[model samples]
Target: MSAQTPEAPTVTTEERPAKERKVPRVVILGGGYVGFYTALRLRRRLGKREAAIVVVDPRSYMTYQPFLPEAAAGALEPRHVVVSHRRELKGVDTLTGRVTEIRHADRTVTITPTEGQPYDITYDHLVVALGSVARTLPIPGLAEQAIGFKQVEEAIALRNDVLNKLDTAASTWDPEARRRLLTFTFVGGGFAGIEAIAEVEDMARAAVGYYDSISPEDLRFVMIEGSARILPELGDEMGGYALEQLRKRNIEVHLSTFLSSCVDGHVVTSTGVEFDSATIVWTAGVKANPVLNSSDLPLDKMGRLNALPTLQVAHEDGTVVEGAWTAGDCAAVPDLANPGSYCSPSAQHAVRQARHLGDNLGRFLRSAEPTSYEHKHVGTVASLGLGKGVAQVYGIKLRGWPAWFMHRTYHMAQMPTFNRKVRIVLDWTLALLFRRELVALGRLHDPRADFRDASAAPRPKGAQKPADKAPQSEKVATPAP
Candidate 1:
């Protein structure tokens, strides 16, 4: 018999050891309050072997929106108001990209990076934290003329724009031109609008002292609200108090009014008032990020994710969508404390909901029962300007300095990290010791303009230089909405 080599053992596909299951990946969308907190919590509680964490957001940092007014008014360093995700969310993969579509049924999300081709990221668990955006109307010139107040960049641009306006108004001899440049109009009378106008007005009032031709009285601050009262969250009496205080500052408080048009710097209101305003700030309100419309997840009438008390995404039939969660301004979480009503979209609720959602998500991964999110809203507080504010806490009302102090204290405690808190405190201390920084860096808005001009091909001699483009002061730099 021919020497036959022992036949190699034939291993069937089924006999091979099953590939080790991959550690579950938790994908969090949006780096706002909920996304940041939830990722931080998961990384702390779960080891690498337990699960992998990934966060995707268009911005690498999270803006502490409550401090935006202070940032705009130069009371806080603009850098301090935003927390870097890469610095804070250690041990987690962070993708700076916009989530273009979410297919929860397939457990996959498509993210388009800031500069690259879109890609798909599959996750065992999905988190929808895509927060809100400025809710704007189709009013004429609004999209082209107004600036929003939702981010740090907008706040800084606004500060510069206001100062630039003052500069232009002071140098001009034309009364009409000066009036248009000095008029600052704010739409919406909610906390955001009220705080923004108050803070900027306060800053502008101080900045005007630098210009010999401008006085505080020469500056016009107008606030228009479609509702009858401002700060409605503070209740009728407190809202009334806020109204009176704003009026005392000589701010025009036009209640039951809406901005009908603002084309070419001309503003017309529903109440038939017309004026020319070079600066129009839109703080009207925020709506759930429109990206939700692209997702397969359940959403409420307001286009927000429908969430149960446990912060899990809920189906229309009332069953939870396993491994799916949501919170912050994007989620319509039922408010157990207020029956038949969902939690209000406020930083107060967003912070608490984020922490609670983080805890619940951690519990879910460990196969433990999730707890419902329940916290009575403590109250509402708003800063009118430096050394002035209004607050209503647990049915108690306060105004002026005491309220302002409380506003600072409460937000400081909730500003995210020790580093940020310390920096903000330093800013405040320095402000008390020195005058507010009144310099405007409007050029920051178009940093490349000069370079682009220099790079352009030299015009032919006698070309007239394109009619000597309008001066920066005469041009209104409309910020991102």
Candidate 2:
């Protein structure tokens, strides 16, 4: 038995006019490797009271791009590869928008938001990690035809697009139409282009299961590269192995080929070749976001900000820009590991450099000495669908299933949350216990087509079944002589 007591009146303190927070607000632009890791480490090092961190970007999720191929191939779930900023990054304000300009002198930025009203945000310390945008060409009709491979949504869209193509080909009776629908062309032979082509091809092959008319041999997948070889980052031997594996899968690897035009569905190559395909994927390369060029900071030949070893923006005369720092693809920092080289634009470097930048920023704020950003380059690894892959680390080469397994293991550990990781592990475990499938649900986009004409046709009153009022076999027709 509990005694019920009367409640006392709540005491109100002499409301101190919301004392202004004394800590400086650290505004981070772009929620990528440099932006995410920068804020994440900053919060851990400085505590919430020392400074407030605000992360601004068009998306609140950080994409673990290495597993994108797996997601497309159904080896990993699409959601598992994306890390939620609001959920994982504590003590940070996440703003979803793109920054148009930076007023570095005033320590302020003019951001043109994607929605709502445009606004200006002021900050004490500014971190520019806007990263890069897709590098494109003046080829005709590309803007309307091509897609990028930077985000999770893009991967999922591509997967759906590929499966849809398979479905279109399967149900079509026209030979030319079926041939065109089954053709897929990918430009560039870098990590993105190769992995994307391989994974989508794998998924499309699986989708052929439900199609009695379409066979795996009917599909044609092509990879075009202007360079003499593919996987230029992986060096020669492993790159050769990658080419062989692609050839083994029946994917045409076109070297020293270029895209001249892609008007409508017709694609013309520099090697005097032409084809019509339902899909054309472009993963050629990337360029620094032009917004960085609008800033007053010193820029490199390619318009990337000339970043100091300390990850701070410096002038042509070697002086740090006040309260401004830059990292990732937007910044060209010196590569101490190799003399006379700039750091390559990569996730491996950007993440570690971002962590260091956060620490250096804190050290600078506390009047402590800052350290330079230096790192050793770990080698590259790539998957070739299913249990095929290639890897080169520390001058050692690994191939086949071993490399593929290593690739999955490495990225799984790197995949953001425990919940997502568990789901991915479950997906893989179930995959091992099931049979491979090539199933495409293309009609999901429009399931009303079959029933559309039923009511519109002249029908009897209260027609319960369509077959009831329909004419019977032989039509009971009699001819008079």
Provide the overall lDDT of each model, using Cα atoms, as 2-decimal numbers: 0.91, 0.84
Tens digits of per-residue lDDT, candidate 1, 440-479, equal 8868989999999999999898876566476675656432
lDDT (C-alpha) at residue 481 in model 1: 12
Model 1, which residues run further than 4 Å from truth?
1-21, 455-481
Give candidates' CA RMSD values in order.
5.1, 9.5
Candidate 2 positional error at 180, Å: 0.9
lDDT of residue 354 for candidate 2:
93
Query: Candidate 2 has which clashing residue pairs, if any?
Result: 206-437, 206-438, 207-438, 207-439
Best by lDDT: 1
TM-score of each: 0.92, 0.87
